[model samples]
Target: MVSFLSCATQTHSLKPRAIITSALPYANGEIHLGHVASTYLPADVTTRFLKMNGVEAYYVCASDDFGTPILIQAEKEKKTPQEYVAHWNKRDYDDFTAFDICFDFFYRTSSPENIQFVRYVFEKLKQNGHIYETEIIQFYCKNDQKFLPDRYVVGVCPYCKAVDQYSDLCEKCGRVPEEIENPKCAICGQPPTKEKTTHYFFRLKNFGDQLTKWLEENEHLQKDVKKYVQNWISSGLIDWDITRDITWGVPIPGDESKVFYGWFDNHLAYISTVMKFLGDKGIDGREFWNSADIYHFIGKDIVYHHYLFLPAMRLGINQEYKLPDYIPTRGHLTLQSKKISKSRNWYIGLRDFLSHYPADYLRYYLVSINPYSQDDLNFDWDDFATRINSELIANVGNLVNRALGFTKKTFGTIPEPDDLDEKDKDAEMKIKTLLSEMTPLMEQNHLDRALKKVMEFSIYFNQYFQHKEPWKKGPGTNSCVYLSVNAVHAIALALSPFLPQSAQKIWVQLGMPGKTTDHPWSAISEIAIQPGHVLGEIAPIFVRVEDADIKARKEELGTK
Candidate 1:
């Protein structure tokens, strides 16, 4: 079994520290469901699970504040880049918190610490013969009178032939083209002219052999993602242009006219932010980072950056920082069978979703549908309501309410189980077995599968409750109540990582003293709730997701 325990055990062979990071949300816009589905939520869940299992895991993220998109948006809004990013940074963190993404330190890429670190890394790479300056012809907009960088220029992807892609990244094919084809100024909507300028480049091609060896040796990375990464390596690596003609980014050490590219500085924030947090506590962040297990959670769209640019930079700097041990990559979330486009108003904002529904409802539904792979997942309103109503409310919620509600009304406390009957013994054994089955799945980052296993356990107990018919006051009534309530306790622990708020509600409903996460994950396997333990207030943990509300939401999106 590929259990988290097993992974932890191996890491514990050295130390039990872990650092989890989600892809930084660009500070130019509000976070939408698509943003969380593939990265933030999964990272949060994994971090929570690791903490529950006694791992010293810290989840950190920063707002990507130095991209061309931010600069353009700031200019259009008539606000300085700092003021613009400040507003969205707070706003994005608030939205993420609303969705229960518990980031330990939410910093920004534009912070002084990151700027200094970026410059430090640049100097180190320069000394190590990995940084060089070269003159190249860059797109310069005649109308805008500025050199276009990244989001400022739009063109067809040279490799994939996808139209209207950013010059730096092609979202359609997830490749970073060496140069875009038929480039135009995004601001003026006219073909851009070329101008020669000297810019700094990272010797990404130099680390090709090292990266291939790392990709082949790191078994923790997804096989599917590794396959493509290896293929990209085989196709001849290209040196990355590390400097951009922008004023809002980390300044190149001696050159104030140009700054480090957003990708160059943004990812280094991962290290700078964590080090800032640890430095305040008198901890050696470098020692800790090098020793801990690291995970970088990202969507498939940025695979080229995370897989190539990120590791290669670390390797170039004499491995001052270690590369991520696991990159949990997932596919984009499409809405209603179409691409979710912010410009088209075809997306659901995280805050907007929470206004109409509980966070756990969204959390549960997203994780239940999302698999541990790059295969795209669709979020249809009809499908969302069906899963919440039939699966969450009907299956898991039904079992919890039925079990706890009956126990509160009839016994006013947990009843002593009668001597173990065959069925009772089987149910008890199943709870233990389910935890064993789920451990490896969670460890393997198969959160979708692990959550489904928990739901299936709920189904099994619901059936067991139906078969025993505790309402009939039969001879097995006390035993059924006893086992069922214990099952609710187990379910809450199992569900804690996915549906945390709902799990806490279950913990309170069961009259448990502390948070569900306060108990070790292994406690789920035991019948920890004893007889004579008075039940807390018994109320339904989840309300059925109404079709009318869902319909209104769909209509708001201009869908029929």
Candidate 2:
């Protein structure tokens, strides 16, 4: 039995600053809509929101370039692994750009800086007596000149009888992996030979008691996450295999032949990428890394890795090397309730989606279906048309365009406001109160709920404008227009985090120079548009997503 000690640490500071990271995508495949919706987009949203609130938040992610799957794909194309990764790296960057994922620096794991940091941590683990070498039998593929790791070998699952099950687990049925009955190399399509090799292993079992104490004390985790982590810790722990016989990865600190496991080095890229990003900005990176507030946005598939392996790696290197503060995870993104299968070619690529619709259209839809719980989300083109047309075009777009269009046409600009009436005051109070209530939800990582509140404000303002008939010239008509104009201004401020392009359009239409991000979140409650301000050219920001386009897309995807 392991002896337990208190692992409680200080909480995050009250300041608005944060260091955010998303799950790293592997370099072997095209990044799909599901990936952006779950990982990178959420982090980008958080970073944007934090900066809007005057927070010094930083976000960094890279392409995971190691492991057997990468090598297998490269071999099939008769290209070097490095060439394959570099080719797809450009594609990933382009895809993210098309969707407006403004990462600080979208680097790759093949960089010298990443190798440097991985080696540093490896050395620390070695000196701290947190790593041990062990001889174990692993499946060897002679043609590939490397031992096959998990996700590279296949066998029959005894419990679920699922063929082509991966090592250490059955993904389809979640069976605890057992010894292989029929072993085959996933790449070469041949029987793999078993060979005994010496490899370094991280002493993950050593940190279990400390992890349990720390996890219980850490208040930032989702309640379900904490419960699952605690149950996992209570069950048991295992020493993790942290190195392998591979040539295309970060080498062990002192040995040049052995490579660090993808599990070990992949997560370190989060730290290494941050170091490279901040260090280039002429800022000391450690000041942020040492802080207690660090958040990771990942899909639920990697929960074991992030909650178990990552924290242990940090504690192995140094106690003060802050463990993660909050880990917000989401379920899988499915296409019409089916898993996205690359082999089947049944998924929509980011490029394909952007061809038919604008980036914000997808952004709004994805956030609406964001998996706050463990339930999966299906990307249905029909539903996408409905929401964009109804909630966005019919509601948000109509309101902004009508209010700004009337202002530009009627007064040639905004007019001086009269004294406030009871209804006008009440409308102002509602928007202010809702915006105030949303701040906490965003801070707590409940972005889905906070977004719902923001949309509620949009509808409230729409009704208020309609009830007063602000376009008609009459007594108190100027005050009605003033309230409607200020309401649109407030909506733009609240939207900067979610739909930045639309928000900036609203800002420029209001004749505000620069971008919407220049305005802070606190500005949403204050009256921004003064009377007699010359409004700029007004146009609709969002177009209605048509049913015909969605039907064509569904046909393209081989759906109804």
Candidate 3:
């Protein structure tokens, strides 16, 4: 198979390569807007931006198919775990595709490739003395007739004292406790009795010094996140119990009664899925993965697993796959300033949202508001409509429609400009300057800022068009139309990564060949649309989000 290094050498210049991943969505549930806000949307935007900038980037994610939650839901539905996960996997992908979250390969953690890799990694860790077996007191759900692992047990977090926290991780504090306080069987809602069970544990505590060093050195990691993670290390790391008494997970090697923990196998899908994709193309997946910049985009909830467990596993296996270079974690999305709870019917599913509005509207609003931090974002319906109506439809949509619609009506084609005046020169310079400023913002993962900068570009052109009044048909009218049309072109390019569907519509109206992403991002700096270029059929790219529509959505959520 062709290796990445050899391929880079043959090209005479190595292109920037990246393997981007979002946290695997659980197979147990429908993906809600809350899920998209923090992880998938950001990862998709970053991957699209990198590709637009001529980087070789692949976005891979999988269904987290092997958790107790999946088994519980499957049993409730009277279906096998595989059958249940299969249904949600397809459903999740459909929802993601509708929202334009472009994952290159959306596989499953239960896939044969992943199962094999999980076993392989387990064997390697065992041989390297990073794994050991020990008997521990586990909660036995006698009423449910099973050992309560992970989601099957619930209690207050030992570290943060948050009630109703999962045994594995605390949602309120984002920390994993060695043991939860006041544990009860989630299935029976009764306190569970302790029973001795033999389980395998990974030497996660052994990698404390190494993990600390890596976290310190990796400048791309979020400082706020690192501060807490380092504190977790300083307090002392605990050995991770990697095996569970579950039948739905990856079967332990030569042990049919037990399986590898869900967290143990799920993140390994990141490597296995890449291998599956590239191996089909006759490429060395391992070499490519190790050589490229690895990014694991996640939400604040799973911080403990991705930050510690993921890297520790790779380290135990002698770094066969390199550690993540960047783990861009963002905070949760609240609905109308309240925590979105599915059981409460306060969550908007991706499919449900798409039925109400275009995908780009959601994409644009989320990226515009979500900063590159662990700060929680609220998806207020009023705020959503206001941004879409005032900013997206009014500022950006107005600019494109006026520029192209006016050009189509008056000129029917781009008009050649006369000698440049101070106003005309100043307008052109802003596009170039914004492109320069935006490069670093996107590169550094400040996507919210990058999108806001794009909006600022649109606002400037809107004001410039209003000031120039190309409708007056005066001396500078041709120059105004020329620069305005070109500005629309630049706007389309800038919006490609953020609002792809709208950007594509803008491209179609501009009579540009292929998709907006088909062009290099740098083309935004150029006056590419030549004089006399025939414009496509003129139309407004977006409709104003009506207030009545937002009110109806609020009513559905039982909000006044």
Candidate 4:
């Protein structure tokens, strides 16, 4: 429930400018419904709304191209790590384009600029004494002469005696290896020995008090998000291990033997992407860089990493580099009421999903049922079909098609209504209020409700159509006719952000002059389509998706 006064007004304006970052997709796999619902969809909607509201905003994202996964993937594919990332980077770009996510910059961490910038940040952190080399006794097998991460080695759980417990934790007994009295390497059944190695660690614990103070003061953050952050702060932060035992990452600048840690490097992609876009804009990347208004959209799992480690990196570099002004995080997206597991092969691929349904429909569905700050949201196909078919096709689509169809068939052009009644005025004012109210929420990444607000505009328009009965009156004399035309103008403009292509279709079909993108922000409340306008040929904006089509696609993917 958004307050009425929270609606936009000339006096209470949104910030004139801002920068936003959606967590970079790790370049390991194709994006899934979970990725869309958790981060991309929200970020896309927010960026669109910002552009519509005439705000100077830029969205930045890149592929996380470096890390152990890249190396592991390269080995699996029998390709060089560089070759592997190069192939997937193009795939990711194609996926993003298909989804219509208008990121100003889509960069890759493998870029020379990114590596240089990442190393610079790492160097500064090291110089500031925020990072240090340390080591602990870790399991190693002499036969391989390699350090074994918990996943590589497995052994029987001492307590439950369940065989093949992962080296770090026993799934059956629910105890970590530290709790096990004796363990054998599951690989060779050889006794494990502790060997020490030094690595870089981020002083996350050092900034605990400052992070606590910052969270307490930022009240716009959702209650659930605040609670999550509070829990992390309450337990006290751990100095995050920022170095890894990998070779593919940005090599630690001076220490070629070590590489920039994944946690340390991945989050820096946000800033790195921005610099890549700035590309010597001469505005002093630092000037815009340290600005206080930074928004980060991410999933709940990575909250502390983004909120704490990200800001800490900035703080460790320049105390003045602004902390994230807003962090709008979402819970996970589940498939069939289960967590989307890449290992289990139970995730919804974006490309596969789009093959059956249009991107707007998928975008609309994800936004409609988004869990902005709570737990995971379920993406049941039945729920998906019902929402898009009912809300989108039935309600919003029906309103536009009916109004445009009636206007064209009856008059062959839009006819201005001579007289207006109370209902018409009320509906127009309500639309004004709705459009005004939604801008801020979209800017703040409250996209779930913001989209609902967008849908309600169509709801009201449909309600007005039914009440006014525009079909009953003669073209020139009907007051509802003009009112309906004006109503469609508002609807089209407001819907533009959510469904740009569909909105453009509505705009063109209405015979509005100029491009839909040229439509001003003011047109949402003030009608831009004039009376007595000759519209172009009517086009079907969205085709109904069929069960057979979806089923066939599901079968191809081996989804139940």
Highest-lDDT candidate: 1
Writing each residue's lDDT as its tens digit, candidate 2 over 64-121 gives: 9987678777988999999999988889988987898877777888889998988999
lDDT of 4 by residue, 1-560 (tens): 11011122221445655687888888888988788787877877766666555656678788889865578778989999888988888888789779877777788888888888888887788889888877766677776566655455676775567776764456543333433445556446777777887777778788877777877887767777677667766866667666555677888766787677666777777877777677555555655766626788888767657767787778788764577877888887878787677877888788877776778888888888885675678887767777877888888778778887887888887666665568767876875676667767765667778778877777877887887776667433355666666677777777776777788888888888665556555567775556677877776677776677656655654343
Give one clash count per candidate, in the order shown: 3, 0, 0, 1
lDDT of each: 0.90, 0.80, 0.89, 0.72
TM-score between candidate 4 and the true structure = 0.88
lDDT of 1 by residue, 1-560 (tens): 01233222222222378999999999988899999999999999998888777777889999999867778788899999999999999999999988989888899998999999999999999999999999999999989899999888899998889999998899988888899999889988999999999999998988889999999899899998999889988999999998898788898988998988989999999999999988987989999999999999999999999999999889988798999999999999999999998989899999989999999999998999999999999999999999999999999999999999999999998888888789999998987787788888888899999999999999999999999999999888899999999999999999999998999999999999978877777777888889899989988888887778887898899431
lDDT of 3: 0.89
Q: Each model's TM-score? A: 0.97, 0.93, 0.96, 0.88
How well does candidate 3 score on lDDT at residue 426?
Answer: 96
Tens digits of lDDT, candidate 3, 18-76 = 89999999998899999999999999898887777766788988999997888878889
Which pairs clash (backbone N, Cα, C closer than 3 Å) in model 1? 2-440, 3-440, 4-443
RMSD of every prediction: 3.0, 5.7, 3.0, 5.1
How does residue 407 of candidate 3 score in lDDT?
95
RMSD of 1: 3.0
Sum up the clashes in candidate 3: 0
Candidate 3, residue 461: CA error in Å? 1.1
Those runs of model 2 whose alpha carbons end farther than 4 Å from true positions after fitting are 1-16, 141-146, 156-163, 168-183, 188-193, 558-560
